[model samples]
Target: MVADAMELATRALLEANLGLAEQVITGDERIDDARSACEEQAYALLALQAPVATDLRTVLAAIHAAESLERMGDLALHVAKAARRRHPAPVLPEPVNRYFAEMGRVAVQLARRAEEVIRSQDVAAARAIEDADDEMDDLHRHLFTLIMNKEWEHGVASAVDVTLLGRFYERYADHAVSVAKRVVFVVTGRMPGTVSDDDL
Candidate 1:
């Protein structure tokens, strides 16, 4: 169920990036519903089955993971709105568009990695997910530099729009990393050290 929820969130993000504004908003409801259901199931399992130690950790991690994925869905919607606001005019230049696409791809990969770690209980895969998130952060910083430098120079509104879009994409990837960290916590019971202190 957790895996399914993650997949749905990833799909919602992809749709948002593809310029389906209405669908992205509508899909957020489903993501919220799924998160609620997952929370209920986790609580029920704790109440009825009395999971202990590792089992308890698994349930708690699942709840956190669902929450993170839900936030990712919301961020994706925000990105869609920004995209819509800049409609008919390309906010991102070709190079920035390429970067945005790469960021989206990395976000999806992180989501899938989280799913795999959860389903397989593989701590190593979770670590790899964490490492991949570092790359996303680097790309995010690069995108920011491009926007701030007025690389596209579409004027103030377009620059702001692209900046916000880059921020949303970066945030989406961060949430995915959060899910991966939760997976690692579930398996190993330790929070990993930060790769860097940058907000992205």
Candidate 2:
């Protein structure tokens, strides 16, 4: 549901909808609760079943993925709060709004692809997620360039707010990529850094 939350947060920012921003903020509690419950269940299984090897790794990956998902929710909440903080005024300038809108769309796509990678254990999808994250990083850099340009007239306050929003979206994509990497690790039994193309 964090993907849905991210979409709502993006909608809130793009439209300057205070109601959607408030919903994203309040909806974070649900993500927190769900993460807690999933973690508790994972721990219970580990303790009760004494799972070994692949089973243990699967459980560990699930817990880690849940944490990543929760972090994604928190990042989405930050985006919503930034939007609400600006109220009717957009946190992003009109010229840069399209970049942010594209970033938001890419973020949601990464989340969806991450879900597919997790369920299918498709190494190609996992690798694709990392590639998608690179796109997000490029967008983040472009955002910084816009903010830091000498001709920028949005003022320091606007620049700071835009920077934070960019970071939130960038980090959100990072977490989604991390989730995909974890799935690869679980399926292949190779740690993230140790996994080569042949292994994937």
Candidate 3:
């Protein structure tokens, strides 16, 4: 669900489509609902089954992943709102648009991989999510460079918009990596460092 929202929100932002933007914005509630439902289910299992060791790790991982997914949804929401605010006028300049488009693609990929990791619990595949996130981080840096370049013609407002939008995409990927890392920890009993919201 969050993956779909990210894809739609990216499209809406790129095309400056108000209808799509509105759809993403309004659909955020569904993601929130899913998060709530997931937590409820996880809690019920915990109480009823008295899960232990690997079983407990699996239950806890589900809870963490759900929260990360919800956060990814919120990031997508932020992107849609940015698009709506600049409707009839693009949020991104032409030079940086392609970068954002690529970021969006990578964001979607990471989200999909995270979903698969949860379902399959393939430790190797879960580790690869971090590599994909590194790609997203690289894209974020490229966009930031474009924004901060002295030759940048866009005004401060536009630069700020692009920066925040880039950050939103980067953060979304981070959450996906977080979800995957939790799954890896569940399987291998080793936790990786995750980027926090306050990191950037």
Find the candidate with the highest TM-score and give its number.
Answer: 3
Ranking under lDDT, best-scoring first?
Answer: 3, 2, 1
* Higher-ranked by lDDT: 2 or 3: 3
User: Over the stretch 1-200, how does candidate 2's per-residue lDDT look in tens digits?
Assistant: 88999999999998999999999999999999999999999999999999988798889989989999999999999999998999998888888899889899999999999988888989888988888888888888898888889999978888888888888898898889888988888888988873212110
- Candidate 1 residue lDDT tens string, 151-172: 5556777567667767766776
Please provide, for model 3 over 36-116, each residue's C-alpha lDDT reduced to its tens digit, 9 standing for 90 to 100.
999999999999999998999988988998899999999999999999998989988899889989999999999998999
In order of appearance, the predictions have TM-scores of 0.82, 0.94, 0.96
The models' CA-based lDDT, in order, is: 0.69, 0.88, 0.90
RMSD to native for every prediction? Answer: 3.9, 3.8, 1.4
Write down the RMSD of candidate 1 (Cα, Å).
3.9
In angstroms, give how far residue 31 of model 3 lies from its true place: 0.6
- Score residue 75 of candidate 1 by CA lDDT: 75
Q: Highest lDDT among the candidates is held by which one?
A: 3
* Candidate 3 similarity to native, TM-score: 0.96
Ranking by TM-score: 3, 2, 1
